[model samples]
Target: MRRLALAAALALSLSPLTAGAASAQTARATASRGLTPAEVGTWITGLGGRVGPVQTENGLTFFTVTNAGLTWAVFFYGCEAGVCGEVQFSAVVPGAGATLDKVNAWNRDNRYLKAFHTAAETPTATVQYDVVVLSGEGVAQLADPLAVWLQLLPKFAGEMGYVAP
Candidate 1:
């Protein structure tokens, strides 16, 4: 009888913990239907980075995030009403030191990013990664691409012969 009572008490104690974990999981699933700028900003901040004020231009929204002394902009696209379905992580390094050959090589070698040279008078090297965020992905799922971007930003700058300003 005593053992049965102990078992019942243990089950009662663990039930709340299991229920709480399930509730948190459900909340995350419900919140992950789409990516939002606020959620992105919060994630960036959570990574010990700084996010600039939100900016909109030509019907597109973006904001700058600074980490490890490198700054990049996250641009939102494919918006309907105010929700965006995609995001592009872009960073530009000044100077034409990254020749067409170098840009081509980077594009050929890199897997989740593209590099290009701008046509401006003072040529610049730009690297970008585009992600579709409308696939009901949670923050952890989206962090994979962001992690890749963060890991490659400095290497891209060094390989392009330009320093991130």
Candidate 2:
């Protein structure tokens, strides 16, 4: 009976059904870059879009999150211990309205990211959604959160389908 109770407790803790899909959804990710710190910063190392590296936090570098037609992406660059590199093509929560607020909060809550700031508004269309940049640990400890953000954005859009662009 004690074993059964423990199993039940574990299941309950992991249960997303209770919290709803919005709370339960997770990210899909892949890492394919080995860019050095300098390489990650070069003015010429453009991402799949025009997003540019502009700042750093701890060892984590921050870049402009850009949307290229259909895909909203950003470059989360980080380094830890003796290694440094850039994370390529991570998805970003398109801050259409309240979504940007949520994205900013997410970045603020990030444990591995700090030194947060936002550059001057470029206004993608006319309503420029702010892209808050953060700095934190990289390399060994800097992949999952970035992945989660990227993954959450698309998933959120697909599921919510009502973010009022």
Candidate 3:
């Protein structure tokens, strides 16, 4: 919980993330913060953190996670076209493995999304997408972000149940 704040604070400190900058930067370290390994897992499931796939009216990529009677979410914000996307994954609440499967499921069915996994050391999952920068989500007529989200999801599922720094 507190660690997440510290981690986010530290991560945020690395760069000036005002509305100006677009695209996610390196995953800068932040001491030991956020949810615990197990809790983080649950949070991924939709309990206390942002987990499940979500498309806002404003067109932002927002998802949720659940844990211990809590609901959390992650907001993948800021970007457009093939340009810079202010990559920001924020856990709404610090819970447990609450939205992992949901995220995995969404990734499996999505089309535009692409899940990137490294066989080496700590296998990580990332999505390659093109979004509409203005709204910060998906467009009603355009299916770019939705498609990308679907594409880069299954790969992440293969590495499901992941938890670490």
Candidate 4:
């Protein structure tokens, strides 16, 4: 009788219906939601990046981010109240050796980032990558793109012949 009871308990624990219910409960407990600036800032700090004070301009929010000795701005867009749906990582360097051709080459060779040269008297090379944060996406989803940005920024600077000052 003891062996039979143990077998019955094991069968119930391994049953598909019980497993499905447990999965549903776990999913509900860890579901993703809209992103906020605090969450993003904390995530950046967790990844060893320095996040600057939040600022607002033209009704949009942005802040400075520094990681791996490279500094950039992270702009939040499509914001409602304090939540944002998208972020753009941007950096600009003096256009000393940067050319339209070089910018074009970078764009062609890169997957997630785009580069452009400004036509100002003191020209500049700018690179930007945009990531969309959807309602159903989690921290891992957002962090992956930020990680890629952090990894690629220095490479992009070198490609543009940017000498840090």
- RMSD to native for every prediction? 9.3, 15.9, 20.3, 8.0
Write model 4 residue lDDT over 1-165, tens digit each, in one string. Answer: 999999999898789888898999899656543577777878888878899988888887888888767789888887776777788889986756777778889998888988898867776789999988877776567777877887788888888787666
Candidate 2 structure quality by residue, lDDT tens digits, 1-165:
999999999989877665665443432123323444443444223424454545666754555544323343334444544233445433332332324354356455543322122233421111112222233433333345444544454444443222434
lDDT of each: 0.83, 0.40, 0.40, 0.81
**Per-residue lDDT for 98 in model 1?**
70
* TM-score of decoy 1: 0.74
Candidate 3: stretches off by over 4 Å: 1-62, 65-123, 128-130, 134-138, 159-165
List model 3 lDDT by residue over 1-165, tens digit each.
999999999988866665235333222221222222222233344322334545455766554544334333345443333222333333221123224454556467765553434333443344454333332332231234333433343334334543432
Model 2 scores a C-alpha lDDT of 0.40
The regions of model 2 sitting more than 4 angstroms off are 1-33, 37-48, 69-156, 162-164
lDDT string, candidate 1, 27-131, tens digits: 975553457787788888898989998899887799999888788899988766556778899998777687778888988998888888876777778999998
**TM values, all candidates:** 0.74, 0.29, 0.25, 0.74
Off by over 4 Å in 4: 1-33
What order do you get sorting by lDDT, best first?
1, 4, 2, 3
Residue 129 lDDT (model 4) = 93
